[model samples]
Target: MPVVESTTRRTGGSTPHRAPGRATRPRRRQTSGLPWLLSLPALLLLAGILGYPLVRMVELSFQNMRLRELISGRPAPWVGLDNYTKVLSDTDFWAVVWRTVAFTVVAVIFTVVVGLGIALLMRRVARGVRLFMIVAMMFVWAMPQLVAAQAFRWITDSDFGVVNYVIDKLPGVDYQNHSWFVNPWQGWSVITTLVVWAGIPFIAITLNAGLTQVPKELVEAATVDGASPWQTLRSITLPILKPLLIIVTTLSVIWDFGLFTQNWVLRDGHPEPQYQTLATYSYTQAFGQSRYSLGSAISVITVLLMLGVMAFYIRQMFKIGEVD
Candidate 1:
């Protein structure tokens, strides 16, 4: 005798017969949609703020948008790649590009090294180190850039600066009086000092968090295997820290590229500055001379640069993931 299939009754119709060949999986109930739903609001917010503005910026970059256009209420003429070509040919733009790259590289290296050392020191100390580090870092980082720049300017000023005064008092160290901002080298010195001061805290904070995640067991095991501290750090800590290092380095690159306030205040707004940066150059074009299109062009270039750096970072992450 053949087995009869079971039938179940429904609210609005006659019983439907069930095919009882085998038990089926519960439709693999998707949880991916749940996470997407949870994240949708944040994604929308990010698109609204960053994505929309960037789209508008790209659009405006291609157009000859200006005060005249705005005042006359005329549609901006699409210039295609004209602005970009002009910026590329400009000598001032190149100078700014060089200075910006140098500044970012130097500042990032200084910040990362100093921060890593500080984090290590903070980790070693058991008594009130946290409070001291937090207070010290916060003091420098919390100050307004303008205020810090002004204070530093006064401190490093040739005429009345305490630094020069102290130098003057010192025995036989080239006591030639000079304004620190008078030369390109001096300008970079001031800029680098400010960059290091502003950057070290972030590095220390990030590296310290990374250091915390490094397992004590791993360290002890390495020690038991006759690995020195430096060796252990090289072999294990650094490898484990790849992700955090990538994040820190990428952010540092982006931040340092757009360095403006410190450099500006260091030299106090010279239009034809000897040590111009792409950002400062763009600012001068837009605000100093009201050349909106040129400024927008510079900004578009910067966005491209940032995108390149971001792409490099993503590639590195993918490589690391594959290695893991």
Candidate 2:
């Protein structure tokens, strides 16, 4: 009878309940919330900075916020989608958009191709030469767009430019007095060259980093199996580096699409209205002509286009991941 009473005391009425291996439901819930709680501050900061400005820009895009209204401290009149309608209906706006697209496509394609070539070459070079090449590329990459434009202007000058002098020396060419910026196409060619040259360093460096991760054994095995260099690259290296290539290409497209400083500085303030990019065109509308609302609309369109490209890029990346 004593043993039975002791057993009951130990088993039920007096013993404290404890879970040794697992946490209680409430404690698990608290742990789950901790990550979100920790992230709240950063999220709020981003919302205040990035989110607020984007919202303000969208609001301003639909308003008549010309320079005069701003100067007079008047509340902007909301005009619904008039700004977008005006921009969309304008032939010049469409022309600029097309020009921007063409320039971006050309620049990104050349940059990626040349960058890949350079990365491949770097792998074959001696250590010392590779270092020198990397340093030179970094120097080019570090140059500001404005500074590079100015430098190129000096190089491509009409009378005393080194480029003209070189052209004069070339067979069947006498361009010593050539004023490159006078012609829109010539100006564009110069801009493209400068853009490609400036962009190559970043692409090459990033691609080289990606290349390092590619196994030498795989390449060697492919070589031993009678695969040509081009075949191996097409079948192996390219597939491995696809993600990095996409990232770099997308970034290049975005950067080149919004090209401003190079084109503007190259045009030298005598900008041929016909040759203006979306960025230059928007600036012209807002500050040059005091059409703030119209300019905001253009800016918004540019942002939307970029977002679309990014969305497509992300979708492609996910598809590739799923396939892998």
Candidate 3:
């Protein structure tokens, strides 16, 4: 009998063989251009609508576009960096910048703190109470900014305002015909209060939604492990909520930094020098004083500042994502 060849190799065992004509399947691409292609039309439309105005504003910043040039419809002569130089050199402009920053900081802090508190309260409340709170907040949020501003204006009005009336009701307190806007501190207080009030609903609702994602199991575990409420919140809850906190804080910063309508309406369309913010300053320069170029330069600077803030928040978000 002929000796049979062994199929198994000596090192390991029998070697597995592929079928003669089978081809390996190729992997699908992890990315595709289809999404980008589909998005092109909307992107182009936005570019046309928003991009042109931004470009025009930038172009205007480099030119001497005064009332005369605007009226004549003639091309304004380019003045290079003179507008920027003038704006930067003005002490009043710097004052406005500092004021704006201060207001933003205070408003954002108040909004976030109070909003977070309300969100936590919502979590602990009965279903009916929570529903009522949500509906009330929705109404508040749905109210137009202008309407809200106007309402605040009326409430704080010097003559026969409810705020003064309520204060006057107290013994030894004379608030009759009291003007809230006479002093800068009082005026800014009113503005900040309005901002915080209007902003809280959105922040609370968003944070409440974020709070829903917190793991109940982890919370219970912490409780069983003898963690106090504060400790549990600080360690377990906060870490989970960090990402959302960052987002809401960033949004609040952006909104408060660009404060315009409230201050404008509160001041009766003519804010005193001390009351001027970056938004109002820019508006006053362009429309009020016809210094269009200077206003454009200020606006460009404002955009750059906001961009800086956005960049910082975006970096933070990416870092959190990596950790996750």
Candidate 4:
């Protein structure tokens, strides 16, 4: 019996007297269950946050649903893509889309270029000076976008605007009554200015961080080889900063594309709404005209456009990562 028990323990860790047919190994349930188990919470959260809202939005966007429908609990009448077609056909909508694109491009250019200069400047400073510049930029970044717009409005105001007043008083300068709010292009200039100001901090902070990562060894090596300052920056520093440059540029485009407050606060929806970005166009349709379906369609289009831009950026990001 001892020999048999020892044999059983050595072979299968089972007693010799145990039922051979009935004895079973423990099964690993997680091997079968892990995917479903892990996905349960995410699926639940997605359903809770997105499922109904998206379905309802689609339904509403196809309907002539007004506040009356909410009051009566009646099924909203389906207009069957009228909202979409109308939104697409509107000249104003096209104008807004163009405006958004222009704003995004111009603002991104200035923000990235100016930000790169600032970042380069900060890179040469002592740690104390670097931190101070960063903190000051952080303050501007932290301010509300609307407040920034209003403050810019004050700065560009015809009479009280400090900038115009200063320009007017300068010798041989006939800056006379430069009503920024009146001219179409001049109004857009203010919008661009505010967007640029609001956007600089993002690119600066990002590029500054990028500058820190530029290999000192590579720069020194380049300098030792008789590379000029500009040459060193172009060949050595910029290559290292490329990834960050892409990110900062992409983000700035996305930010300025959705800008509404800068244009709106500048003129309070005046002058035939020439500078209305897509966001404000959607807002005007939804709230200003109480055209919920049309407005929702515009919202859907803007979202889709932004999504396209996001996909492009994501693809570029992956390319950068692969290169790295």
lDDT of each: 0.82, 0.90, 0.94, 0.83
**Which of candidates 1 and 3 reaches a greater lDDT?**
3
Ranking by lDDT: 3, 2, 4, 1
| Model 3 CA deviation exceeding 4 Å by range | 1-30, 315-324
Evaluate residue 26 in candidate 2 and report its C-alpha lDDT on the 0 to 100 scale.
Answer: 53
Per-candidate TM equals 0.81, 0.85, 0.90, 0.81
- Model 3 lDDT per residue over 1-324, tens place: 122225353444656679999988999869989999999999999999999999999999999999999999999999999999999999999999999999999999999999999999999999999999999999999999899999999999889689999999999999999999889999999999999999999999999999999999999999999999999999988899988898899989999999999999999899999889999999999999999999999999999989988997888888878887
lDDT score, candidate 4: 0.83
Model 1 regions lying over 4 Å from their true place: 1-45, 174-177, 312-324
Task: Report model 1's TM-score to 2 decimal places.
Answer: 0.81
Q: Which window of 10 residues has the lowest lDDT sum in candidate 3? A: 1-10
- Residue-wise lDDT of candidate 2 within 19-79, one digit each (tens)? 8996666544335788899999999999999999888888889999977789999999999
**What is the lDDT for 10 in model 3?**
40
The predictions' CA RMSDs to the true structure, in order, are: 7.8, 7.9, 5.3, 8.9
**lDDT by residue for model 4 over 215-310, one digit each (tens)?**
889989989999999999999888888777888788777887888777877776542577677888888887777787777888888888899779
